[model samples]
Target: MEKLHKPKKVFVPGAISPQFIADSIAKHQSKVNIGAHAIFLGQIRADEKAEGFVTGIEYSAYEEMAEQTFHEIREDAFSKFDLICMHIYHSIGLVPTGEISLFVFVSSGHRRAAFEASEYIVEQIKTKVPIFGKELVGPAGEYIWKENK
Candidate 1:
């Protein structure tokens, strides 16, 4: 987490661009305090349902609540680990299957801390955040509500 900074909007309008991820990593190289970084990218999957295969997902969230929940998650992660920086991004609009949606990156002084913190953030976001998504299926455009199983 950056010091003396306002909270950033986490939701992207569509699939997370690859260039954005690359740029983020590149920016961290100048920070000599960070020894290890862990990244987790959650992609939309083309899951086969009874009706057909999932083509895309449209995500929405309770923005005010989700942001607050994310802030708490970040603070907890920092207390539990020696973290230098952390970033979380989730796609908001339509994301095609196989495209990235959620990205969690954690930087720490050691690999262990980075790995654990990154994993923790991803799991907590999935379970705790009030983000809803619809799975648009097949050519017919049938839709189903998406939930973590």
Candidate 2:
């Protein structure tokens, strides 16, 4: 396994704008000799369940732990794959239904590495991070946090 590098910044906040993420990626491109860029956007879904309709989502995280985990993930991605650069951002607090919950972007010198690294970053986020999210449902809604599968 390759050593991981920490991202320049990581935050667990109330909301995030897609434009902000795009801007951040643009800033990182200066030294990136990237020929390919791939991105993954995760949106909150309104799920209809036996109980009722899921209206929105609220996210939370162990920030210190998540950042450390994210740093390791970044380092591993750089060492294992030939990526020029990569970024990951996730929303915290109350994210309205249908809004984006997470964003992962990867850039590389070639198409293959960008695509692969994009997938790797997301998979690592889902399985390794200490972030948690709760699903809010119905008028008298209940909040359900995600459990590891």
Candidate 3:
């Protein structure tokens, strides 16, 4: 297992690209012990709202606090699950509809642990992290602060 305490870079400037995700998975090919990897991608949706349809999402956060909370969530996941490693990335700026905003990848020796831990990590991030999203709802740039459900 890798070292646990080092803080990882979790924030990307915009949408999480497919190339980035492919590269991440490619890099893990050397870890033969990892039998399964669970990945969760959060994509921005073009949902019709009272104002208009959502065009995109602009994400912002208190960087320091968000990073700390992410680290805490990582630690909790490590302690609670039989994980080999995990990675998480979230968008910081504008992500257009149908683009990825969040990526969560969890690896383990078996499938069940990886799947369950990925779910738990995603739930923790959605509920506990302080990241905020501003939904661009109209063509005229009207927006609303998104609330976590």
Candidate 4:
């Protein structure tokens, strides 16, 4: 059996911050070889429910399984696309409706690979990961289990 690459940490304790994102981008400025970058940020939405309106999302996951799935997704993307860099971060706790819960970044020598890889990574995460969310709604703080649409 071939050895799999060790999984990197993909889960954050809370919402992904704008400053962290900005710093990530700024760090890549030194990589002159990268010509194109694609970024995707998944924000918690204020979707109206029958009981109330969504104020935030409380996220949870099977950490071990999710990490392995993430590693596989990364490997598949690298094999399928000529990517120079890729990152995936997901919130593991409460993230306000306007705050970012997920962040995906991909880079390549050209635009197409970066864009395609970015999309692929996001789609794979949505479909394959074991992450779950509880949508915290309204003033009463009632929550409904969220399903990916």
Candidate 5:
């Protein structure tokens, strides 16, 4: 695996900030050939559970397997689409409500390919990766493990 693919670091300790996302887009401005860029941001929302309102989420993952899975997904996306570039970031640890936990960016020369590739990568990550999360609910610090449905 080391020779085949050097995995890029994907997990951030906390929430991904708006500034970071803006900075990433700004950095790609020099690549004038890229006509379309699609971005997917997974945000933690305060959902009303049967017990109470879910306040936040604590994410965890089987790191080694997840990294390998991500690499495979990236390769598959590149092979399927005419993409300029793609980057995926997922948050680990605690993320408060209204914060972003996952960021998937895809760039291409055309809009359709960019959109399709982005959606494909995101769905693959959600279903294929070994990442797990627990929904932190109520005022008493109770939590319920979440499934990637």
Candidate 6:
């Protein structure tokens, strides 16, 4: 019997569209016996803070490190959960406020696994990956890096 390999994790230094994520999920279905799929989309929010009105977000990452970290996270999730399939994507460039910045999708034989895995992926990305984003704000265009705090 052939062993099943995990789905490829994609990293692009460009804009991310919802269509791209949907396509990825569709392609992974053959390896999954999914009865439930859960997705989480993180959008750039315009924050009105003490600094000023947030305009957009510009993202950056330590690509090599981020990729390695993501791969490890994927393996951990597969081993820890009963998920059949999963994918995670995050924008690396400028993303306008209200646009999707991160997307996570998970499929499982049942709803509970799907839901829990989806949450786990997002949390891992935020804490483990070297990706960071700067919140562009104010009429004069100031930028501040966003931290987990």
Residue pairs whose backbone atoms clash in candidate 2: 4-75, 4-76, 5-75
lDDT winner between 2 and 5, please give it.
Answer: 5
Ten residues in a row with the worst lDDT in model 1? 1-10
What overall lDDT goes with each candidate model? 0.89, 0.79, 0.94, 0.92, 0.90, 0.80
Model 6 segments more than 4 A misplaced: 1-9, 25-32
- Can you write out model 5's per-residue Cα lDDT over 1-149, one digit (the tens) per residue? 23333568888888999999999999999999999999999999898888788888999999889888999898888888999988899999999999999999999999999999999999999889999999999988798997676
> Model 5, residue 72: what's the lDDT?
89
| Tens-place lDDT digits, model 3, residues 53-106 | 999999999999999899999999998999999999999999999999999999
Clashes of 6: 0
Global Cα lDDT for candidate 3: 0.94
Candidate 1: residue 88 lDDT (0-100): 93
Task: Evaluate residue 13 in candidate 1 and report its C-alpha lDDT on the 0 to 100 scale.
Answer: 90
* Residue pair clashes in candidate 6: none
Put down candidate 2 lDDT per residue, 57-118, tens digits, no spaces. 78788888888888888888888789877877888888877777788888888999998888
Off by over 4 Å in 3: 1-3
TM-score of each: 0.94, 0.87, 0.96, 0.96, 0.94, 0.86
Whose TM-score is higher: candidate 4's or candidate 6's?
A: 4
Model 4: runs farther than 4 Å from truth? 1-5
Clash-forming residue pairs, model 3: none
Model 5 scores worst on lDDT over the 10 consecutive residues at 1-10
Off by over 4 Å in 5: 1-6
- On a 0 to 1 TM-score scale, where does candidate 2 land against the true structure? 0.87
Candidate 4 matches the true fold with a TM-score of: 0.96
